[model samples]
Target: MRTYSLDDVYATCKRRDSWWTVYFVDPVACRAALLVGNRTNITPNAITVFSLVLGMASAGCLAAGQLAAGAVLFYLSFMVDCVDGKIARLKGTGTPFGLWLDFMGDRIRELCCATGLAYGQYAATGNVDFIVLGVAVVVLDLFRYVNAPQMKRVRDAIREANAARTPPPPGPHEPLPHQSFSHSPVPHQLGALTVRSHPVAAQPSRPPRSRKSRRRLLRRFNKALARRRVRTHLISGIEFHAAVFVIAPLLGQAALIPVTSVISVLFVANEIFLIYRMWLFTRSYSAVPKPEKSREHAPIGGSPNV
Candidate 1:
């Protein structure tokens, strides 16, 4: 029999993840999934599809005014969503199609849940305003969805450029020691034991910025906002939907749904602004020649040995 440590569970997660994902959600769900996965042949794509079904069922429950059941299903879907990615990373089975499918599922779930909650509220209170709010939520969410890829492209381009400029580390190094696995004969305690592992976050290597370059106030501001740990937790779609559709409804405060739409708009606007800044940054660097190493005191138009 195989035994897994908490470190094994954490190794599957992103170093820099959303605060709620890191702190509240993924750790528990992924750990549970890891244990189940050790004993089962369940695939990550299957879990993704299962999560989507749960999300749809949650939306149906919300539309039928089963608030408690809807909230429970919605949260369960989110937990499963967390599990799928971890499972994929652990099993080395993550694919581009799987990622695309997961994203598409999230968008569908968001739209359905928003509409369901709005319709449910309208049915309960006869308020037409809820319909407008629901439409706003969907539109803003779509805007975000469209812009996300563009933002990712810009970020990827920047990373590529930085990687091209950075010199590779000297190699011909000693081989890394082989890792060994162990199995325990006795069962160990399960659940509620938190173990933390520190993984270094990857940052692009770039030349030091000059004072003039640093004075690009807007870029500096956007960079600061981008680096904030709490930003994703507060404004990301998953967290927003969880708060609005699941937590708020569970607490019997469906009025908070409109506020979530407003927050979505704000988040979308912020993303658009950041994308614009990244485009400008990318454009500025495109004109610059790539840096090359030069020999000290090398004569012009002659070999270094001259």
Candidate 2:
């Protein structure tokens, strides 16, 4: 009897990266990691540091012209990455720092492996092209670094604006406080009793809604009942995929790098925008009135008033 939420949907999408058509996913690998997580000793960040060590050692070997060793090392780093996240999920001990480390380590490992490739090519051929490729990867990564924070700020602003527009919820978020929203009689002595409920829509439908239609609808349903926890997976995926396909093959693809880089950057930008969208949803939901409260209050004259 497993209860699922919006996070389940997003987690499913994210977990696709390491899933198997034939066998179970890397999350299966995380089972071992979870047993390790339960011990009073093993920490997620510790696992993160170990993954970095594997990545760095592999990059060192590759840069020194050890091709197979570098590839093995690179492979090991991703394996460790899976374990860390798996451990977090399995143990339910998610930490901000551990999550941040996992993300940073992934990004750094990609850069390091790209650098190792350039180094290997240059050292073997005595050509500057490979080295130049490494430098370009670093530069593009810096662009992403700069974009991330700026986009976060924009998202925060949108969340705040949406929050201001959506009135605060009428009841307790956790335990019900001593003071609560209540309804009093409408002051008419001989009138019929009436109740009011304004319908709140569900998640988006397949036919596709107009922008104005969807925006208003989402703002109504996205609150404490759901958190945008899965959004990190989304932005992370966009950034990771963009780096892999669009940014990684820049060595011989001279004319294509700029175009790919632009598309990747915009993809990241769009991911940021998606984050804002999720935040807006959460802000609206956080402020939505309770169902009973909606049921208790009726328009005095039947003319829809706030």
lDDT of each: 0.73, 0.57
- List, residue by residue over 28-67, the lDDT tens digit for candidate 2: 4444454455454556688888899898887787677666
User: What tens-digit string does per-residue lDDT give for candidate 1 at 10-98?
Assistant: 77777656556666777678677777668777788888999999999999988888888988998888889888888787777789999
Evaluate residue 130 in candidate 2 and report its C-alpha lDDT on the 0 to 100 scale: 62
Worst 10 residues of 2 by lDDT: 16-25
Q: Estimate each model's TM-score.
A: 0.65, 0.49
Candidate 1 has its poorest 10 consecutive residues by lDDT at 175-184
**Native-referenced Cα lDDT, model 1:** 0.73
